[model samples]
Target: MIGFVEQLLRFASHIPTFHLNVQLLVDFAATCEAQLDRWGILEDVDIAIHYISEIVTNTSNGDHDKLQLALSSLYRERAIYFGALDDLKSATEHGPKPQALNDTKHTSWPSKAIHAGRTYLAHGILLKDTVKAQGYLNKATDLFEKVIAIGSGNIALLVYVCESLAWMCELGHDAGAEPRLRRHLGSYLLTDILDQQNNPRVSTGKHIGRIGFCYLCLFKKGSNQKDLENSIKYYNIVMNSKAIDKRHPCRCALLIGLGHAYLYKKQDKWAAHCFKTATLLEFAIPALRMDACFSWAKVPNIDLVEVYSNALKIAPQLAGLEYALSHRVDNAKLLKNLVQEATKAAIAGNDISLALMWAEQGRGIIVAQMLQLRIMFTHPGIPIIQHKEPELADSLRRATTSLHQLDALMGTMDVKSTRKLHRDGVRWNHLVRKIRASEKAQLGDFLCLSIEKILQLGRKRIIVIINAHGDGWDALMIRKGDNRPQHISLPTSNERFSSLRKDLFNAGLRERRSGDGASGTTGSDNTSKVKGRAVKKIGAQPPPPPTPDSILKIILVQLWNEVVHPILQELGISVSTILP
Candidate 1:
């Protein structure tokens, strides 16, 4: 009889007709009453009556159509179970019934409430109505509380309640329903959920990644360094686990998270390495293709462009010269492609800021190439005023103007002050200043000084550290050498003065390794040692490279010759040697 009741309930749950199920349940209730009468089991008969009454009351009052369906199904299943149990009770009333049959009386109002509440919650999610969904969740929680009050040690019920709350918090964040969701996280025994003993559900690497990410989000909301550290700790655990296959979704998020953490902490090189590594891994995974399309569409390929640009900017000697000579044409083409990709993404995302940033970064690259070209072709000793080619001067003027406009647009874009993002902004700002200083020379000297001052003072005001590409050398001390001043600081040192300076040397090396360019690696330790010896060797040697005046002339001449000339050629503008 017990086995028959169990089978009947299982079958009723899968049935299609709510009304038929209810009718079947009503007939089964009648059968139970008859068996109880024959056996004289009054207590068993009374319990079955209450269960039937509760189901009927809830079903009749249910607000939604789906609730009506669920109530009818439950009514049918309840009828079958109660009828069979009543039969067994009648047969055993003369003696003792089985424990299962005896326990049937305990499943009463609370069980019905829980089932109904859960049904409502599921329907709400299906309807995509958050407010209605939360209302149903409240109902479910109330039912769960009732069960607990009645001392029901149903682990499944407890787990279900906890899982519901956790999801509520996550969804609430996505819906912009709350500013912080961590407060609700404590409601769930997440640790216990992950525990194999308490949870029969399988744990996946993605689950671990979610736990880590939740913690990371909490840390981001506050300045709790410990929470941030713990976030990284959990990420490491998941990444190191055997469950974390390269093909897993968790791998890409974990990599991106680690990169972000490093970047936020002002670890640019490490952050770049992580970002690059994650990009490679993400590209390999077919599932992440959409994510890649979205992310790459937002930002320009500045990281790659900067890697090469900074290489030439810093060390005009050695392979830097050769790299600039060979890659300028190809690099310009790549930058154009990146701009197109970014434009497409911007249009797709409807993000005006991202579109502008990408556009400016692309323009910056073109300007940078022009600057490089001017250095290559312009007569070594001539000033702009003395240059015989009027076309060259005009091209230089036009490129400088374009660069200024690009700078202004980039500067006005809304960039988050994350370490990487801010650093990128700062690098662009510095490039702008450099361009302005190069174009107007003495005329822009005051503005250049003001920019430097702003940067120096801006340090204290910066609230977030962002990963800004390029050598990020605005704060580095300039050492005079040859025609251009040499950068005298190492990148990534914790020293207050040198911290923001990223190694153009290592950036070039990685760019080459990633097949972007030829290697222009500068061993920092070796360079430092060599510099120390050189300074000692020439304690009071000839005065350092010419004052800022000579440097300015050289920069202006280079900008006019390289950037402006090519742009004019592309635009079909005739060039002539004449003073503006």
Candidate 2:
């Protein structure tokens, strides 16, 4: 068959008639598509698309067979193989020739239904048009019912139908029909039970993982104990099943689902075990490992803060990892609460030095270091920045600068320029890593000052920390010579800050409108006000008291009034002596 197709291509250039030449190219493209369908050759399918485009362009509108071939090449073969909907779209642009041809053909009802079902499945899954996908799937189901009514004993056709329908059901999940679709999924999976187990082709890891995922989806859809049990059963079947490819990405997800099931079942030990095992999967991507580690950290039975800490180190800078965590984890609280708990643990063990080291290894390393500096500088007798080990401070400053550079590279590298500077980034990363490791080893625990140690170094004064987050701020206080850190709730919330900013923005808009309204009066004050508003509107400078520094000053006074002054008063300090 391959040789015959090659011969057709070889003779094409020798044909004299332009019409015949175009027909030969069409034939060649159809042959290549047939080869692709037979052998699943993606590269051949790509080549076929190019040829089909050429023929469809040159062939006249009345060339039904050529157009039909092009449509089939795109809608059926190429779209399915490549998962790119552009060809399907192009095929649609060529009219419904392929669908018309399929209707006229003498193929079996089951065959036609499965083919149509697959085309719709590709459209739905790839194009993300849930409504169109679902509508076509319904049409496919009716056709499949007719095929079954004809008493066809085709196991392959039945399995294909079941698989397509199962996928549509899964797709409907994101469209918010999860519970209803999951109830129907069991029947579809049952249709392929024999094939899934005994048919060697159907028993591959990918198929098994899909079946497992259906159950996992159901598990997530329900809160009952039975849902958890079923999820665990199916996931275990996939995990423990023989001859399945362990390196597949779906296996990572399957493991994560299994871990979540165990967690819901109150099997904390099992859940932790599953998550840790998922993290160790050699083939799993870093994003998957990041999730596994984050989930593992949330399990109360495990004290693997170091594992969570390390996972967090790379999570924020990686876009996909950050997105995944944003959906499933309270990342801000996770880091803050973890820090607080680590600090308490260290205090309990009388090893505050270890707590400081832990900070440098995790998500808030830079922030923790800055806070440490604040604690040190606020001490009455502590030496100034330059005087406190000048060489070490300089090295730290350089390391901090390199860290900032690394962040910029991670956040801003365009795809076109990445290749050019890829080697440079790697070298910079290696150098930075080496420097940090050396600093940690040489400075040991003292690289980060323990609150107790810092407070003891100077005059007896209390150190207060206000950690701001997206949702709210956390305040921690440590008196000089105190062991335990005191947690205080801040008066300001994210909502309040956001509301304040919004009001200020509205006021700016109002001022700009007022300035514009008065500008035409032709007075100097009005002209000056209009000019000032224009400057502020254009971001030349913020309008007067609404500047960032002014906002900060306002917030500082409010904080002192609401929390700081009250604490000082409680500690026997005169509130009148303190200036806000």
TM-score, per-candidate, Cα-based: 0.28, 0.47
Please state the error at residue 319 of candidate 1 in Å: 39
Candidate 2: tens digits of C-alpha lDDT, residues 296-343: 888985776555444544343232111222322444444555555554
Residue 11 accuracy (lDDT) in model 1: 56
Show the lowest summed lDDT stretch of 10 residues, model 1. 473-482
Give the TM-score comparing model 2 with the true structure, all chains together. 0.47
lDDT of 2: 0.51
Off by over 4 Å in 2: 1-203, 216-231, 241-248, 263-266, 293-317, 320-415, 418-466, 469-472, 475-492, 512-518, 522-553, 559-580
- For each candidate, the alpha-carbon lDDT, in order, equals 0.40, 0.51
Q: What is the C-alpha lDDT profile of model 1 across 1-580, one tens digit per residue? A: 4235435654544663433245555555555544432222222233344344334443542232233333343333322222223322222221112342234346545555555444444433333445666765555555565665676635455544543443454345233322323433343555544443211212444455555566665566555787567666656666666545543333655667666665556666665655555544421222232233233223433343333222222211111111222333544554454454443344345543333334444445545433443442353322542254344445544544544444456555543222223233223333323333344333231211122332344444331111112332111111122121111111321242232123333444455655544234434432423322421233445664344344445445544554444334433468864323
lDDT for residue 412 in candidate 1, whole number 0-100: 57
Q: Give candidate 1's whole-model lDDT.
A: 0.40
Instruction: Give the clashing residue pairs of candidate 2, or none.
Output: none
Candidate 1 — which residues are off by over 4 angstroms? 1-189, 192-202, 282-302, 306-580
